[model samples]
Every structure is written in C-alpha cells, then in structure tokens.
Target: MHTLAQLRAGELSGITRLDLAEGLTEFPAQIFDLADTLEVLNLSGNALSSLPDDLHRLTRLRVLFCSDNDFTELPACLGQCQALTMIGFKANRISEVPGAALPPLLRWLILTDNRIENLPTELGERPYLQKLMLAGNRLQSLPPSLSHCHRLELIRIAANRLSELPQWLLTLPSLTWLAYAGNPLETEADAAALEGTAHIDWSALRLEQRLGEGASGVISRATWQRNGQPDTPVAVKLYKGEMTSDGSPLHEMNACITAGLHPNLIRVEGRIGDHPEGQQGLVMQLIDPSYRNLAALPSLASCSRDVYADDCRFSAEVALRIARGIASVAEHLHQQGITHGDLYGHNILLNDQGDCLLGDFGAASFHATTDNLETQALQRIEVRAFGILLGELLERIDSGLSDERRKVLEDLQRRCCQPQVLARPGFSEVVRELRSL
Candidate 1:
C-alpha cells in the first residue's frame, strides 16, 4: 500500500505493484507518475471517486482492478493505453460509456452495477472483447452493431430495462452464453398485448445450431428429455437479447406449441430452462428438410440466358404439387384458429418425403373467435406470401405448363395476391381447388 507521501517523494520509483484497497478515497497524481513501470493496480474496496486522466500514460500497465469503487465516470484518456487489457469497474455510478474510452486490446470488461442506459455501437466493433458483463444497468436496449464482435463469447446483461431485443444478436455464430432476466418486457401482461395466448411449459432442453434469428430472439436446434428418457432432438427458440417482459418469448413459444403439430407445421416439444441463455428454450421437433428460400435462392437474372431458359421449363404437375402442399398447411393453421403472419417460401421447409413444413413463428398469432378481422387480415398476408412462393417455384422447375394448368395457377395466385383481404379465398378453398388439378 503506497501512500501519497511516498508517491510524491519518488519513494515508489521501482514499485511494480500497488494495493490501495479501502484506504484511499482519491487517486493521487503522484502515484500515476511512479506507475510507469507498474503492471498491476488494485484499488478495489475503496471510495475513489475518479481516476487520473493521465493514468493511461503508464504504457506498461496491464491489469486494473477498480471494482467496488464510487466512480461515476471513467477518464476518456484510458483508451490511449495500448497495452491495457483487463478492467474491473463493477459497482459504480457510471451512466455513459464512450467507445473511445476503452482500448482496442481490452479483453475483459466487468461493469455489472452501473447506470449505463446505452452502449456506443463502436464497442461492438472491438476485435478483442471476449467477456462483457453489464448485468445491473438501466439499459433499455442493445445496438444491432454488436454482431460485429466475432470473437465475443459470453455476454451477461441481466436486470436491465429493455422492451424488444435486436434480431442480429441471435445470428452471431460465436456467441455461446447469454443471460437476460428481470426485465419488464419479460412479464406476462406485456406479452399478452402481442397476442391473446396461453402459457406453455418450456424447461429442460439443450440448444445447438440456430434455425433463425430475429429482432426478438433466436431459434436453434435443441434436444429435450421425454418421459424420464434421455434427450430427444428438437428445435429450440430463445429470446436473443434483453426484453421488457418475459412473456413475449413465452407467448410466442406457447402459441407455436398449442397450435398443435402437423406434417406441414413445425412441432413444439417443450422448453429447456427459465432464463434465456440458460436451459430456457422452446423444444420443437426438428424438421429434417432443406430450405429453398426464394429471397436467397439465385434468380434467373443471375444465370446465362440459355441456362435460364433451360431451368424455366415449368411443369404443371410440379407446380400443382407445390401449391397444394402450401395450401394444406395454411388450411390446417386456419382451422386451429391460428394465422401465420408471414408464409413466404423462406419459412416453408421441404422434407425428404416432399412434404412442406411451415416455420418461423415470429409473427404467428392465435384467434379463438371465428373470422375475426385481425385473423382474416393475417390469413390474407399469408396467402399473398404463398402466392409469391408459387410464382417463384413455378419459375424454377424447367417445364412448360399446359394452358389449363397455367390458367388455374394464375387464378390461384391472383386470389392470394389480391390487396383486398375479403377477395382472397380461405386456405381451405385454395387447397380444394389445387386438389382438383
């Protein structure tokens, strides 16, 4: 423990270590000068209000332990320390964190008990950040730019005030552990606003590959134990980042599960744990199928004219098959008082048996009442998406369609694409007509 007098007298010239724990209330500038060769500094358990602005001048300093301090703000010049890597500022009053205040080589940043409401987007661009702990903050949301941190592995942000989560957070391939609890957005009432639905049990599951990533959370491959047996493979859906209410993710998961299982619909098995990053994830029967997302698939415009023409040979039988499969799924969902908010080709999966499975329930809703306007509108939107998918698929298979087949499919597409919701035929009607073909 070096005192201010020793620092001022240059008595600590060769001091490579310093411990000012619980004894000092302010950082002495004189100590900063003698720390030119200091590599470790532990000022924890003290009432230090601020750090010396020129503290970064200690070019050889490597570790900083300032946890349990009274720091409301950090010195901006700390970024100049090219060699600094570990920083512990837990239990402080810091509300704002500028991107430039942190060095690029920083690997561990622990800021659990701060008033930080937001993080600079540049923080996510850091290449060396590995573990970020911002659990006890007043943060309302996270920046989508966090996806830039390819090396980030663990992010603990519990007890924050966030409403909705960003989608890109779920798509990060490197993220292995995440925690978001004690938020208002995770409440039951808040989730009820999105859709009037019931809760479903989703605990005791293990997650693997991500199936889809969205603004609210991520859907991944998971496994669940059945009837005291070992794990059963399934797909797990998890809320990605901070949420205002726990009910939002729960509502979506429950809706998907209660909507009942179908050959064309992804089946929900159960949930894993209670927290987002923990075992808490929705377990659904995995669809072992290939996805032909129209949005991502190569279009005829990208290929040579000859190749494009060769692939554009549309077959009526194949067109009818695709149309019928989609209609059948839509019909089932409608009968169960459920409406798929978006039903594009990307959400449709094709199994080995040539069956179509509807997925991506990010926007799905339930309607206990019959023919409600909201449900009807959702159905209309799904029809439009199905119509778009039909057009794209027909444009893919290389075969000319008979005039009769062309007329029928064109009519079906028209009904589904109609801007007037009432003009669109119900999914049942579409399926009946396709079966006739």
Candidate 2:
C-alpha cells in the first residue's frame, strides 16, 4: 500500500505493483512515473470517480483493481493497455460498461455489486476471457454474442433482474462454474420451502476458536446452550452481510437451509438470530477433525481448476467412492430445485476412509422444478462442473491400477465433459455408471 508522499517523492518509481487507498477523489498524476515498470495497480477503497485519459501510459500493466470506489462507468482508456488482462471494479456505482473500455487480452473481469443493466456484445470477442463475476446487478438479459466465449469458465450472475435464463449460456463449451440465484426467474415454491428454519438467539451461544473465513463470512467453533437441553458443540458462520462476488449472504443461507440434511452434506442445526451487531449467521454440525479439503483453490496459471497437493494420490477405489458420494449429493440437490454451482474439489472434504462431504452454499441457486427444460439445462451445466472435478480426481489415481479399470474411469470422464450440452449425462446417470464400476 503505497502512500501519496512516496509516490510524489518518486520512491516507488521502479516498483511493478502499486496500491493506493488515501481516499483521493481524483487520480494522482505522480503514478505515471512508474508506468514503465508497473504491472499491477490497485486503487480500491477510495472516493475516486474517474481515471486519467492517458492510463494507457502504463503499457506493462496486466492487472487493475478499483473496487469499493465511486466510479459510475468503466474508463475507456483501459482498452488501450495492450498487456492488461485482469480488471476489477467491484462494489462501485457503475451502471455502464462501454464497449471500447475493455482490453482484447482480458481474462478475468469482476463487476460485482454494481448497477449495470446490460453487457456489451464485444465481451464475447475476447478469446482469452475465462472468469467473469457480475452478481448483484440490475441486468435484465445477456447478450447473445456471449455464446462465442469458448474459453469462459466461471461466471456469477446471481441477484440480477433477468426474466429468464439464456439458452446460449447453457451451451457454452468451456463453462464449468455458474450461479444465478436471487433473480425474478426463481421459483416461488423454492422460496417458500426455504423458510421456517429453527432460529437460535446469539446470546445463547458461547464462541470459541475461529474455524475459518471465506469471501462472504467467518466461521467459528461454538457451543450452543438451551434452557433445558445440554450444551451442544457446533460451527457457526456469521456472514459479513455485504454483496460478495458470488451473491448475497441471505441467498446463501436460504440455499443452505433448503438443502436440508443428507449423509453426504454438512448438517445445519439452525440459523442464528439477534446478533449483537445484527449480522446473519448459521449454526451447523462441526465437521470431524479427520476431514480435510481435497484440493487447494485454483492458482493463477490453472485459472479455473483446483490444484491438488503434490504428495496426494487417490487409489482407484477411493476415487470411485468420492465420485459416487458427490454424484449422489448433486442428484439430491437438483431434485430439490437447487444447484451447487461451485462444486469444485476445493469445496469438498474427505477422510482417509474415502468418505466425502460436500459443503458451502455460497454459490448455490434455486430453479423451478416445473420448468423441465430450464431445470434440465441448469442441471446439465452443473454436470459439466462435476465432470471437471471427477476428471481431476481421476488424474490423481494411483498409476498401478489395472489398465482396464483406468480405461473405464477415463471413458466416464469423457462422457461427463462432452461439449454437446444436452448430450452429457445427468448426475443420476453419472451415479448409475459409477456404481457399475
């Protein structure tokens, strides 16, 4: 985090990255001095409403972040930076995305928590585009040209005003992770069904050590006390209550409650009420200590896929066990009008015995079960995501396995990842095939 004084004094002239957050209402001209060497720039958490027209001076910049600012539009000068590939303007008041504001080499673009109502057709023209975050916006429809995004993978369009899901979005070849909850198109049945969860007052819980934290909230180990009942150990997630890149915390909590309980899913005890600070929270069954994340989050190089630890290896039997467990839970979720949009290995936990549990409702969405076509397409899209995970698991299988057995698993992965959208099998079919193996 560089200060204006250092920049003005030319002390940061040779740096490759610069971060400034002094609440300036205008661009600092001194930043141009590092244009020759700067590769990443962050000006987030400020009151800035515009950028310099000559932002192209940073010819070597590859990543730019201006989240939590006051910008009402994406700067057009960003298009001239030939090396810029990643741009983020999250939590801004942006209502417009000019066609000429985007660079051709863009790969990751985040405009979450904005007021944008439409996207440019040129967004699909970027051949290298992969990750796109557009949740919490006012979009009514998506451009048909987005179908041309062959390299696209992760996309979050939740909390928008879209009247219907785009058919072209369902057929995107490289799409793996997708979320569209909190839209008008969501079903009433699911909304009503998601309510009536048990509520626990915040004062009754005794907080313990911190468990973990994610983009939406922080989890902690706690002990719940009842008037006549014995104390119970549980895991509590207190949401930060802000619009995240994925969607709102309220929607995630609803999805988690609607999902109910299954052997393969983490159990939700109840929702937390009367938080001292008015924050939303949930009380869930604490996972056993033996369980650990199956893989790490994706790296810059891998872009959209999970990266497993190098020393990890799964036996053929263990891989099948993990596949069957996830397939079973996914089928259950779809049957309840829910889609676990972010079903990656990084979200799954497993024990040495190969028993797996799928958790995290941050990217889950609800769809109308009566709308068969749309529901089927939505499920198939998630099937592709699961297939990608399955393929990754298979890649870590022990090499000494029989060639015939390995061939069977490889063939199943190919079928799951088929580019012809509807041609791919559903989770139920996937489970059936895995059981036969």
Candidate 3:
C-alpha cells in the first residue's frame, strides 16, 4: 500500500514490488523510475482504466494487478511486457479483450466478475497458461483454439451464459478443477433433493468465535437455540454478498442444500435465508475440534497442487479408510446431482482415527443425474481430480502396506489420471474397489 508521495520522492527506487492504491485515475510517470528493479506491481482498488503506451519499458515486470478498478478493456500494452506471466483485472467492467492484450509469458490470468463475452483466440498460443478465472462473465462459448492449451489445469466458468460446455474440455489431459454453477445450462435441483433441509431463523443462532474465513464466506462457532430444548453447539457460515473467485455464494448455499445426508459430508443442520442483515448462511453440525485440514493451499511454486506438511504421513490402513470415505461421499454427491469441483486435500478435514469429512461447497456445481453422455463426462472429469488427491496421499506414506495393496492403489490412481477421459471409473466403482482392499 505505498503512497504516491513516497514514489514521487524517490523513496521506493530500489524496491522489487510496488503497491499504490490511493484512487489513481492514471498511471504515475514516477513508476518508470524503478523499471530496472520492479518485478511485481499492484494498482488495484483505484480508478484507473488503462495503462501507458510505454509499459514495455518495465522490462523486469512479471506480475500486474488492477482489480476493483474501472477498466473497460484489457490494455494492449500489457502484452509488450516480455517478462509478465501473471495478470489480474478482476471486478472491473471489462468487455473487450484484445488479442494482443495477452502477455508473452502468461501462466495465470484472472478476469472474474467482468462483462467479457468472448476471449481472444491468441490465448491458446500461450503454452505456459495454467490457471484461468473467468467466473461471473457473459461468455457464450469458448474459443476452439483453447483445445491447444494442453497445460491448462484449473478453470472456472461459473455464472457465465454458455449454453453448453465445450466437448473439448472433457478430453483435456490436464484439467482437474472446474466450476460451472449459476448458468442457464445448469440443471435445476429436484424438488425432493432438498426435502428435509430445515429453514433456520437468524435469531436462533448466537454467533461466537470465528472458526475460519474464505473468499465466499465466514465460518463461526455458534449456538443453535431450540424451543424449550437444550441449545446445540454448531458451526455457522455467513455468505458474503459478492462474486467469489469460484462463483456466487448463493450457488454454494444451494449446492449445499441439494447435497443431502452423507456420513462423510459436513452435515448441514439448517439453511439461514432470512438473516437480519439480509445475508445468506448455513447452520452445520460442529466438526470435532481434533480434525484439521489435511493439507495447505497451493504455494506459488506448486501453482495447482496442494502442499502437505512435513510430518504428514499415513499408514496403509488409514489411507484406505480416507480413500473409502471420500469415494463413498463422492458417490453420494454425484447421485444427488452435485459435483465437488474442488476435491483437493485442503478442502478435507481428518482425524487420527482416519475419519475424514469433505467440506467446502464454494466450488461445487449442480448437474443433471440423467444417464447421458454429457453427464457421464462431467463425472469422469471429477474422477481425475480425485486421482490427483489419492496420488498426493500415497506419495506421503512413511511405510505400512503390503506390496499387493500398494500395487492396487497405484493402479487405481493411474486409471483415474489416464489421459483417456472415459477410461476413468465412476465413484461407485471406486468405492467398491476400495472396500475390497
């Protein structure tokens, strides 16, 4: 959060990164003074709409962020920065994305919450491209050229206007995480799917200590008061009223409600729709305090993979239990027409007894349960995500399994992660196989 005064006074001459956000409407000429050393620049939370013509002069710049601004178009000069790899222009009014606006070495691009209708065909030419955040946009379809991007791993097209998901995405060898909620093409949840979800009133919940916070909502420890009965301790999630990196918070709440009872799922005790503050929320059964996140979120270097702790090790028995729990719950979710788009270890909570619970509907999406090809392909896509998680857990084992058990687990992983999308088995099949082990 640097000030324009400090930049103008030459106080930040040798800095490698700069953050100036005091309502800037135009690029500061003084920024060029440190072009020799600057690598990352953030001008977010400002009023800027465009960049200067000579932005290429910052030869060392590798990352740029201009989110929460008034930009109507992605600046073309940005593509001239030879070293730029990551760019963010979220929460803007951007409707135009020029073909030349893509940087030469791009890896990650964030354009969530914009009005984009189409993408530049040149985006497929960036071989290093991996993560793409395009939620809350007006895209009718994806460019056919995107099929050339074999390295793309994670993508979010939620809240868009696409009538159907491109067939090419199903066959992409590397795609793992995907979210497509809040779109017209989405299948409506069956009326009977949410038959027993209780409508909890806001006044019944007494919020207490904060449990955790994420981009879409805040979770807190609370007490669920019962009429003429004992109060029950619970966990409550109050959704934020804005587009998240994944998609709408209301979509997540809806998915949670549609996802009915599962032993390994975070039990949704009730839904809170009439909050005094007009916020949407959920009342859930409090998970045991001993259970904790299985792994940390991805680091800068491990861009799309979760990072585990140094001491994170599991026995073959414990590993099988975790695998079985996840497979069973995943089978249940898809049966209810819900897909847990983000199935990373970070979204799971576990205890020493190998009891695991899958949480986080922020990236979940609803789809049809009909026995159609499109529905089958969607489930198989998520099978790859599960394969990635199983692979991660297997790699962390300290030693506790027979060679035969190890071979079975490895083979299952290989099948799940195979380049051929249709070769992957469904969650029910995965559950049966794990049960045999």
Model 2 agreement with the true structure over 318-347: per-residue lDDT tens digits: 888999999999999998888989999989
Among all windows of 10 consecutive residues in model 3, the one with the lowest summed lDDT is 188-197
Record all residue pairs in model 3 with backbone atoms less than 3 Å apart, i.e. clashing: none
Off by over 4 Å in 1: 1-212, 225-231, 241-250, 274-280, 289-316, 351-353, 372-378
Q: Could you give me the TM-score of model 3 versus the true structure?
A: 0.95
Candidate with better TM-score, 1 vs 3: 3
Candidates sorted on TM-score, descending: 3, 2, 1
Per-model lDDT = 0.63, 0.89, 0.90
Q: What are the clash counts of all predictions, listed in order?
A: 24, 0, 0
RMSD of 2: 2.0
TM-score of each: 0.47, 0.94, 0.95
Tell me each candidate's RMSD, in Å, in order: 15.0, 2.0, 1.7
> After TM-score superposition, what is the CA distance of residue 394 in candidate 1 from its true location, in Å?
2.7
Candidate 3 ranges with C-alpha deviation above 4 Å: none
Candidate 1 per-residue lDDT, tens place, 41-72, comes to 77888888777777777878777878777888
